[model samples]
Target: MSNKDIITLLHGAGGSYMHSLIKNVFMKLNDNYGEVGLEMLDDAAVINDTVISTDSFIVRPIFFKGGDIGRLSVSGTVNDIAMMGGNPIALSLAIVMEEGFPLSDLEKIVDSIKKTAEEADVHIVTGDTKVMEKGSLDKIIINTSGIGNRPPQLDYNINTLRKNRQPSRWLVPTNLRPGDKIIVSGTIGDHEISILSSREGIGFEANVKSDVAPLNKLMLKLLEVGGIADAKDPTRGGLADLLNDWSEKSGLGIYIKEEDIPVREEVRAAVEFLGMDILELSNEGKVVLAVSPEYEKDVLEELHSDPLGKYATTIGEVRKDISGVIMETVIGGQRYVGRPIGSPVPRIC
Candidate 1:
């Protein structure tokens, strides 16, 4: 648990420990001095007008109710680049497999990767694969890196002093302002619940399928409507972590209503039975957006028009005077919504 120790599962859980690890260990390696850099800790790195992002997937079971590791690999990286207001163009995949792993399973995974790539309209330009000793590793692990194109004529600044300038075409968490609206793309916790069910062999009355899909198309529509201040995919740390990151990074307060956040009845019941907060669970397909108040209605309408964002709703608002995240409970009381800590569920993505 000390700073000078080796890596732990908690460090990969996308929580406080992970953030600290990145800041202390990896952040010092590169001085991203260009226009857009890693210093911001954004979802994707923007270099020379091109957006690039990389992610690794090692989910247990490899296959889930709604998505497999292969699909997750492609969509996860694609969503990362799209969250940065970029158009995903291509991807590269690297895979590590254990000896004695079934070739049929590998073929199924590869087929899924190809299908997802076609669905997302991105090319798989290159790839690599390696096999390890049977006892050296788990069944398989996948790493994907994606490239995207950012608009050339869009403002990237988020300074309030630059009021005369047009709103940024590129979305960043730091772009949030007071009075901006906060929106969630859809129900929370579906993906996590689905994974948990599959892992634990729990059978509920209603099947909880993972909400994992490529969201670049929905993001494109939002960008077309304009006025989007910031956007983040509620992946590893879920809605709570994403909102808390925005609040802490922007030095602004975000107030959300618990009842307003859309959640499937089955997922809610499962969360209650498991005694877990839905906000802390991961979502693979949802985007949390911060939009200008003036365009809030339009943004909601545009989101509703897209199949991916059919359940989009405004769940909160940004506050310049306050800091941190607060949630109004169903009972009319408010409580602090802190960033997730530790690895509540591991190998989730």
Candidate 2:
């Protein structure tokens, strides 16, 4: 193989190896920044204030039903910034590809990265790439990091949240009153189904697809409309896990109406077929919003303006005394729901 095309182990050795790796592989992807970065290589980047996060994806199948590793890599990082209440600004990507991987597939991945970024409006600023011997690794693995400044409007803090605070003052859901309403944006479990359908080689009975999407746009609008006491992306553990954690942290009870919970029939059927609890399935593009009842309409209105939140609705409420999560059965009973204890489907974020 031509030296320019072939990867050498020296690229990873950290001295000349790392330098050549950065020069030959990483530089081609990110372009030269400046001398400021020549002095240090940080795993983290400055976004705004103190908000920062990092994530890695080693999904077994690499490519899935609704999205591929490229989009996942970008969206996952963007979601992390969103989860931290920050606006996504820039990202860096790294790849470890096995030898003999097709250039066509690599081009597809690059195109996917560009498309996802264009939709999200975030820039891919820097990255690294390496190739291992054919037998040493999977076809590819991706690592990415991002940074962004949080808008002053979000003004998020865990402790400032409580019943007595101003609507915009922020209250930790731990203080959730028995009367707190649980709001969810759009549907759930579709992302898991998408991956399953791709992995298991099954087709949807209807037309269910992944909920994978970037929530930054809709969330910016929601923040403007007010009523968001707390917000989070229902990622790995699904809404059930998120609610249970909120219940435990705030020393309050969470109650939900079974009939009110949103689920597409195809997704529901897939969950039933796979013997998976719809509550524990992963979601990529969905968010969990806990808001006060009075402001719920304004919040919903903001959500409805965007395609992502067309189905936004109140699913449940917070309670004062129970300190656990419960769902009122459509059959006229209430059952406690707990956080998912195990990794039901890993690498979902």
Q: Count the backbone clashes (under 3 Å) in each candidate.
A: 0, 10
> Candidate 1: what lDDT?
0.86
What TM-score does structure 1 among the candidates reach? 0.94
Q: Candidate 2, residues 118-215: lDDT per residue as tens digits?
A: 99888998899999998998688888788767575565333234345544222234335556578889888888777777665445443566777777
Q: Give lDDT tens digits, candidate 1, residues 1-349.
A: 6855888888999888899998998899768764568898877888887899999999977998899999999999999998888889999999999999999999999999999999999999999999999999999999999999974312432332146334444677667788989999888998988888888555553488889899887887776676778889999888888988999888899999999999999999998888888889999999998888877898899888888889999999999766799999999999999999844788999
Q: What is the lDDT for 266 in model 2?
A: 88
Q: Each prediction's TM-score against the native?
A: 0.94, 0.79
Show where candidate 1 strays beyond 4 Å: 1-4, 152-169, 201-206
lDDT of residue 6 for candidate 1 = 83
The models' CA-based lDDT, in order, is 0.86, 0.70
**Alpha-carbon deviation at 99 in model 2, angstroms:** 2.2
